[model samples]
Target: MKTLWVLVIAWASVAPAASMPVCSGGHRVNCVVDGDTFWWRGKKYRIADIDAPETDASCEAERRLAAEATSKLKDLLANDFAVEPTGRFDRYGRRLVIVKIDNKSVGETLIAAGLARRWQGRKEHWCPAP
Candidate 1:
């Protein structure tokens, strides 16, 4: 019983940051860039599991959906969450991470809500090309 309990506790601490660091020393304020990107303590992180519509969307529908996804992302980040580094970075130089809340993926939440899609090796269009 004791060994089992210890293992459970240890596993829990291995991931989930609990809370991201706040801004200090005059760095940029922490904020979400889009559904799958955010800034924390002056560093940018791209969510590794999903690809959301770009803010500069090509179509009106895409633009609107992008805004909705961005808003949803903002609200989700307001509560307790975790940022688990993926040991990789995007071409734009943003560190990649998997953000989770209580072990549930933030990306999956957005996907369920029709706000985002699973990321493939390359970005898939949010809408048909113009």
Candidate 2:
């Protein structure tokens, strides 16, 4: 009985850490890595619910938009912004978060500007095939 109780306690402790970080409040961003990623207090975070063009894109159009997205994210994070975790993490270990600037989500802003798209469980092409 005692062994079973110990195992249950151990599982409870490990479960939350294995899931994802939950942001009850917010944290100051240290730097913006891209339109969908940033650094806060030395930890890397990925914006939740949205995906942006990759910085190392091959297609010309994708590359161009990726640069624009990165620049826009940099500008947003340069001010007094905060990141709210989405209680999830990507496979790459980036914390899924929502960046808020003036109470507006940066991801939503990027999507509105056509620089990003809402993440739908898979990556979508940023440019058409040649």
lDDT for 85 (candidate 2): 61
- The residue-by-residue lDDT of candidate 1 on 1-130, one tens digit each, is 9999986665432322434333235465577778788786668888899999988877888888988888888778777777777779999999888888877999999999999999988987777765
Error of 2 at 111 (Å): 0.8
* TM-score against truth, every candidate: 0.78, 0.74
lDDT of all the models against the reference? Answer: 0.78, 0.73
Off by over 4 Å in 1: 1-27
Query: Which residue pairs show backbone clashes in model 2?
Result: none
Candidate 1: lDDT of 126?
76
16 Cα displacement, candidate 2 (Å): 29
lDDT of 2 by residue, 94-126 (tens): 988877777688789999999999999998888
